[model samples]
Target: MTLITDTISRAAITDSPLLATLAERWSPRAYDADAVIADDTLTTILEAARWAPSASNSQPARYIVARRGTESFTKIHDALIGFNQTWADSASVLIANVVDTTENTNPWSVYDVGQAVAHLSIQAQHDGIHTHQMGGFDAAALAQAFGLTETQTVISVIALGVLGNIDGLSPELLARESAPRTRKTLDELLLVND
Candidate 1:
């Protein structure tokens, strides 16, 4: 059996080890509509995200979720980018990650939200689930449908499910589906502390 290890050995030096895992956590628009995700599992994923570090200990992040085959889910997907809407149509669940910027005076709140969502995506992968973060969405529409308060700002939409058949995807999507991880070198990222 091929064991997929997250750690890279010195002999197996690559451009970036972090990219290996981060890239492994790629967002695929193609999802299995037939996949059934339990509510408990979804709750746990959110729970992990909730605990991520926030600036000033201000937990301003919130989420509005919807399962597939539901009116809410359909509406949320309808507001997605045309390309994303096409493939995300097959996702098993949808989650709208919102942030309360009114509670946070600093700009770090948005960065904190991104971190929390990143944690959620990584945890989802560990739980045998796949997630796609979408920025190409109508925030106002999602907020309106979910009865969001004026203070709450919608940050991103997440599509979750087991990966769908590659063949079911478009040629363009298929080309991107299995591409290897690419990133900048450490020389460009690190600074010499002389």
Candidate 2:
């Protein structure tokens, strides 16, 4: 068993009030192939997204999940950018998040999909699952191959699973794999209510 060390704890923040553990969350690109995400866990993650607020509650967003070792996952993963393929190849599961724009005729179904993804991200953190939200796939290829309707919008593909060894990554990717998070300060991100 991998020793429970400060590094893992560092990956998952154990402090904070509103967010008890999400601080440790980051986009994961690698995973253990032997890992099997249970159906219950996937359902929990979807349930979190299901409750996300939507414009007029039309809830047009939908998810199609494919696990590792399945042809569906291969069909989708094969469509990823070459750079992503190197690390994402080992992901235990992949989720194709899509939006149906016609569900409500609302112009912001895409934005609602974003909200749903955000909810899923945080929920993954809470569930001790790692996630990487990727936008580097060929949408046209996926649409053509998956029989996606004209009214559907491909939002993004999310890789879901446990963390893996950074050493397994190529040196170029390793340099980026474990980099610390950077964010604009509140002063830069927040605006005074004028």
Query: Per-residue alpha-carbon lDDT of model 2 for 48-96, expressed as tens digits?
Result: 9999999889898888788998888998898888987888778888888
Off by over 4 Å in 2: 1-18
Compared with the true structure, all predictions reach lDDT values of: 0.78, 0.78
Question: What would the C-alpha RMSD of candidate 1 be, to one decimal place?
Answer: 4.6
- Which candidate number would show the highest TM-score if scored against the true structure? 2
Q: Which stretches of candidate 1 lie above 4 Å from their native place?
A: 1-23, 191-194
lDDT of 1: 0.78
Task: Give the Å shift of residue 181 in candidate 1.
Answer: 2.8
65-175, model 1: which lDDT tens digit per residue? 889999989988988878888888888888888888777668788888899999998888777788889999988888888888888988999998987666677778766
